[model samples]
Target: MSEEEFRDFDEELSEGDPEEGEGEVEVVEQELTKELAGECLSLLSRTGNGLSHAYVRLDLKNRKLTDIAAIQSFVHVRYVDVSGNYLEDISPLGELPQLLTLHADNNRLATINLKELQYLQVASFAQNKLTTTEGLSQPMLDRLNLSSNQITELSGLTETQLPCLTSLDLHGNKLTSTIGIHLPSLQKLYLASNTLTKLEGLEGLRQLTTLHVRENQITTLDGFAPSMEGLQYLNLRGNAVEVLSELTKLQCLPFLRGLVLAECPLCELDEYRVEVLILLRGLERLDKDEYTEDERADAEELSKQRAEEEAPENETVEHT
Candidate 1:
């Protein structure tokens, strides 16, 4: 054979034949396409299934969910988490009849219709462009996290609709004051990092356990309710509260444990300190950021004593 022909034959053998490589590449491409199509079809079928519980998460993040009509088929879905998507309007989610939890945070949702979610228990709409908080009717909701929104007024959540709401987070919002929020079952409230100048509309919640109102313009605790008998943790740090005497109403809360009062303009008043000691008799953690070494030692001693008291008892009996 000629040298050129032999060289071509050797190249063909070294490259494993072009036809074989082409066939292998085609098979791989076809398999990948089939797998992609199967996943899409499975998602579509799941949207069509009207089951009571559905979880379509961990895969749809950052994906554009433009097909709103696909959600109408899943009418029986109780919990739906469509967070981290590029969804514009979530009005189609209202079509679900049994939706209990809607976690649509970190989305481009400009508006939300809360009237459709009657069975919703936990709704997290954080990081949205919501200007107002209107049209919510779920009375059995337990937690509502609406932080990082543009809400100016809180008049939308009335007393009757949020009767069973336990935790509410409105941090980093534009709330100037706390009005029209008559939550009776509220246990923990997070109103930190807002534009609140005064604290109001939290008196009726006798079941309050934790109250976080730090980094606000609150100058007084005038509107603090004495009926909050169940409050345990209170974080009022970085406020303009001059007098700590207003916290005297907390004496009613026998379970008060932790109190954070750092950065507030407070003086060492003997009577007020005595009152705080009386009110927080059951307190295990008190952070003022100004505790001297001696004071910290005393606190540590008290904590050790309390721990000993809480420890299980060991008994010894002597026989006659």
Candidate 2:
């Protein structure tokens, strides 16, 4: 950026904050003025019609802005970055009918009720004070990041609201269960570092490939259904899973290749690795370690022996 892009602080700010304190920084109320807009706007491009010129990217990061009512006039902008600011209200951006991408992390936004942008694809509102997913509705959004927020429940989110969503990051939230999420098209889901005790209502997400629920209170694998056939990577590390039977529920995931269970209470068992491989023979990696040839062969033998032992009991019951 050129030197002209930076604003010159007044004499009072250059010296120090005299009344506030020696090290404290005061937050002055600010707005997105027309002059500031002209200074910040940079990426020039042709419109979708290819007839008119317009600035498509408006980056105003770390401007400490509280309001942005002036952005409504920039109707042609497609990408915006207003992160690291003191903004608590951004309803002014709802006017950008052509916006496709937005990054507004680390803000003071308590509620987000923007008008549905049909072309929006990528959105990140991480590290905010959002309590729910009530107002986040983007029809064409592909990737969304709401990590490190105060979201307790996905009350208003559904597959119908985010039909095209593929990747969702909701880690570091306050979610206790996975009930309200109904996104069937999602492939990647990050729900680590939450207060979830059990996994449920995720059978609808048949297309999910990666599921990260690390560092939670989950003690068993009761919620996994046989319909999750596309799951490849399952991260359940740093949980309280101690029983060996909890992994039987994951045998339905035919495509599962990676499974993490380190730091769990069961990892301390002498035959933890061998037992897991015996139950889920399809796993190629476990706890960040790839299985060796000998390990796979030994587990295969143990699995056949275990299954044969159970076959006699089943046969006796059927004969009766």
Candidate 2 global TM-score: 0.87
The RMSD (Cα, Å) of candidate 1 is: 20.4
lDDT of 1 by residue, 161-251 (tens): 6767888888777889888677777877888778787877778878887888777888877666668767777777777877756666566
Question: What are the lDDT figures for the candidates, one per model?
Answer: 0.63, 0.84
Candidate of highest TM-score: 2
The reply for model 2, stretches above 4 Å from the true place, is 1-26, 307-320
Clashes of 2: 0
Best by lDDT: 2
- lDDT by residue (tens digit), candidate 2, 121-224: 99988877888988877899999988888889887678778999999989888999998888889988888888999999899998998888888999989888
Q: Which stretches of candidate 1 lie over 4 Å from their true place?
A: 1-59, 267-280, 288-320
Model 1 worst lDDT window (10 residues): 5-14
lDDT of 1 at 293: 54
TM-score of each prediction:
0.67, 0.87
Q: In angstroms, how far off is 13's CA in candidate 1? A: 63
Count of residue pairs whose backbone atoms collide, per candidate = 0, 0
What value does the lDDT take at residue 257 in candidate 2? 83
| Residue pairs in collision within model 1 | none
Shift in Å, residue 185, candidate 2:
1.0
TM-score of 1: 0.67
